[model samples]
Target: MTQPTIVFSPLQAGVPAAGGALEVLVRVQAPDRPTDLATAHLPKRLALVVDRSGSMNGQPLQEALRCVTHIASHLTSQDALALVVYDDKVDTLLPLQPMRSTDAVAKAVAGVEAGGMTNLHGGWLAGAQQLEGGTEQTVSRVILLSDGQANHGETDLSAIEAQCREWLGRGVSTTTVGLGRGFNEDLMIGMARAGGGQNYYGETAADLYDSFDEELALLQAMYLRQVGLKLLPAAGVIVEMISPAQQLADGSWRMTDLAWGAEAWVAVRLHLSPGMAGQTRDLLAASVSGTALDGTQLQAHAPVLQLPVLDAAAMQALPRNETAYTRLEELAFAKASEHLRQLAKEGDRQATQQALDVLEKRFGHHPWLSAKIKQLRQLADEDSEMMAKEVRYSMMRMSRRLVSKEEMAYEGDETHVSESVMPSFMRKKVSEGKGKKREV
Candidate 1:
């Protein structure tokens, strides 16, 4: 049988869009074969951490157990699998052991029991330890699941973040999954970001199985490791990574959550020199270690996308224009402006307040921005630590939107406030009972 070959093709490039941005499209392909591509043995080590807190006693625990069993069954005897369970304390049910022994794997996963409080830190530590030692060529990873907050052992979130950073530095990737509504979404997402992996939300036990299956499928299909793009733009050209992820120590950039499935696409923006005519320039180069399921490594290189630098006059002369590029440009500007606003608020409160005021006066018609300003004002007034943290968490999670009315209620609480709850005192008059008070 012939081995399958993966290929990528450039679809489009250098098209002027709204806000003076350009769009590039590419397609990835893998030739069809008979046997499962994922059945091949790869030098990969996976640590599975399950939440066995009291809240997970029933359906959650059962689903997690089933998921781990399925994961183990899929792995070749050559791969390694470690199982860790955490509640008030962390315990490794199965150390870094080969997945080839079905009976041993089954026994390890079947022993998981639920009780006590959620100790996320301990679980992470245990998982990190399991992945500590590996050959330079091995791919180490951790899959963590939890259904509640970390209230038992080492509740310091910053410390946990620092640990994750350290682990990623050592070439171990950690992905986190929130099992239910009780789990801290912000913490899980932040940990995933810090650990250089992905975060997932599972609303129910069934969802847990689905998430596990999806993750396993992706892992099996990975033909490359340490994949990254190095853009060396010509003079007067600027290249920016649209996706917010850094290259790993192995020189491969971990794909962000945005580019997970086969259907998802990755995008980048390029700024050209002014008054420059149509001239082809090397946009970027992508490098990935092509590896088969059996751990055989090969080198794969993507040809640089040649971009034409068009002058302003020439841009205007281009034929029937599509607004896709313009929309992307607008999205980029909105994202950047929101980020700046957040940084200003964190770094200098006074400057942030002034900037908010100016933005409100100028773009007050934008409902989302307007609503965010109102929320900020309300947070500033109430001076409630919990509310402030909640607002900040919401902003970080919903950065794509200036305002998200769906309030993220405090953990173990169900109360929620509307976006209109906090009116901007500067722009609108307060209402007394049934009537709106006139602004003086």
Candidate 2:
């Protein structure tokens, strides 16, 4: 069976009605064997950093404890585990200990207690240390759980980011789970990106379990690290921004924007020179490759280029002609640019809303997308910030309706109201709207 190839497209917007200078064509090769496409067998090292702050004194704390215990119990003798609990100061509940015995694991998990301020930095630093010792391991990971913003220890976000970078440089990946709204999603998100991992917001204890499952899956599957794209345009071809920009290194490109245990796609744009009379020209070329965390090699080639051929008369008229190809190309570029701008805003609600509105207006008639927009709007109405954020993220991440019903329900139920059981009145209203639109 051929491996499925996934293609990421740049978000486009505001193409001129005519005479645009850019065009984009995307080809995706989604990996085959979805079950383990990204996760092949590898040695695993994990550190679970939990926030047992004073605010997590009740249900949250209990749930967090259960989560840690459950996760520890699942580790095998070959797997290594570390526990870091923090409040005002970071505490190393368990050093980088091999999970060779269940008793040791139980003892480490049982020792967790809730108290003090939220010292995220201290917790992260300690967790980093645990994994640092396992540098020889192929797949190393960190799971950071926090219930509130940083209030103690080093509160500077930049410093925390620097630490995350250091760990990533050593082939360590991190996934962050935010418990409740008290935690800073931006901070967690940033930390995850810096470490080339994913981020999740857990509104309840059950949500935390789901997050843990995902983290486990990622740790088990990650086969690549520092995956990058280097675009080398044919002479005279100009390339623009790469969508979902995590970083544009001086010598390479790096992105940690992909979801955990999931593949991510990026879009790139190229500009071509105007065709000469009765002539054709090549436009661009790209090479993509990445190093696995375990030092495995994975790569793909993209020599496919778009060429424009024009006759003598057509070439003479190119400067003044308004052609279908030109119009479509302009629209595509505009759409891609706007999409990148919105994504880069990073947590700017207003900008996201505006972008959504534009997408709806343009593609609202598409049945699937329309339904998703409606469902997303419902989540937004319920003031489920996390769900809303997921909706936005999903749209950008997959560029399709890849989000599952269970995930939606998980997000909606954060308010304790089952989205599946919508009120009769609201259902009736939707039905009526559909009826009216059909009649029209």
Candidate 3:
């Protein structure tokens, strides 16, 4: 089996003689060989948890059931599957069992009807329980679909995060899909992060299929799990991670799964103290540990990058990595967007506007981002819920939006995935650019 590669890009030019800012871009490349889904044959234990709240009575419920049908039809006999539906009460539509016959599962999904308020916690927990009986070698996951807030049975965000963390500790990952504008984006995003899984947004009924298909593609292509990075920063240097994670007590961060032919990048800003002139010092070091696709342990260390404290002129003579700078800009925008969204969620209109003003002053030159900022400011004034949801979705999918055309393309004969799977905001942003320079 091929091993993943680790590369680090530090500040190209040396630091100022009296010490200056430092930023490092850490990129983890997937295995050298492309993933072969037919050959990999990774077994999956999947739980499909669908919300049947009153709001999903019409097209929403129909679309959800149709999507689930598509997902069921693609499963193999070796995979274990469970279906759960909830609306103020939980119902196990189909008990956990291997997919030897999908007809019964599809029939069960078709019989679900929408009613009552959402009991998100109960539904999600029931789904997680179904996977507990699966083998340790299976890739166990819960695909949670919801179109409303948690109105019954443990609605608190903290409580929900704790519960999800408990499930993740038991080796089950939960991937959350917010069905429409009515869903609470913050709650879904938080739950997914705590579960060490992926989060998605479906703006319209038609969008549900895209979210379902993309997630399936990822699962079928995933090659690594238990991904963790140990950062060994040089003494006296402070490290601040800009990625979503569960920070360990020892200062390391826990990451999610890594798929084949995909790249995971982590960005960290280093705060350094001034050193004596004409001397070199180690900036940072990192080691990656994870479980590979073939059920083998994998470990790789990134090269240590050293910084030189030199004259300002000498530092200016060095070449910089333009790609690294672009990636950093993307990370900064994502961070600011998240902060602004949180402010909007709290109904602090003034603070939200102030944050937007600051971002405009910093990134107004970029057309797409500037347009997005303006759109968000208007939404904040008119509808805070919409603004918050938009911000979270945009930031969550930023990396996918910035990927090159080749990276987004698929080589397999999966002809059903012809529709655009990107979020609506991303589509609009890409269309307005007219081939302008991308900030990410």
Which candidate number would show the highest TM-score if scored against the true structure? 3
- Residue 236's lDDT within candidate 1 is 51
Residue 150 in candidate 1, Cα distance off native in Å: 2.1
**CA-lDDT, candidates in order:** 0.55, 0.56, 0.73
- Residue pairs with colliding backbones in model 3 are none
Tens digits of per-residue lDDT for model 1, 74-181: 678778989899999888988998777768867776767889999888998899899997764566889898888999888887888878878976767788877655
What is candidate 2's lDDT per residue for 6-101, written digit by digit as tens? 332322211222223344433323242256444345567888898998988877877677767768866777788888888987888788877787
Best lDDT among the predictions, by candidate number: 3
After TM-score superposition, the amount by which residue 58's alpha carbon in candidate 3 deviates from its true location, in angstroms, is 2.9
Cα RMSDs of all predictions?
A: 12.8, 9.8, 5.8
- Kindly give the number of clashing pairs for every candidate: 9, 19, 0
Shift in Å, residue 151, candidate 3: 2.0
Whole-model lDDT, model 1: 0.55
TM-score of 3: 0.82
Q: How do these models rank on TM-score, best leading?
A: 3, 2, 1
Task: Give the poorly placed runs of model 1, Cα more than 4 Å off.
Answer: 1-20, 25-39, 100-112, 136-139, 154-159, 169-171, 247-265, 278-305, 308-440
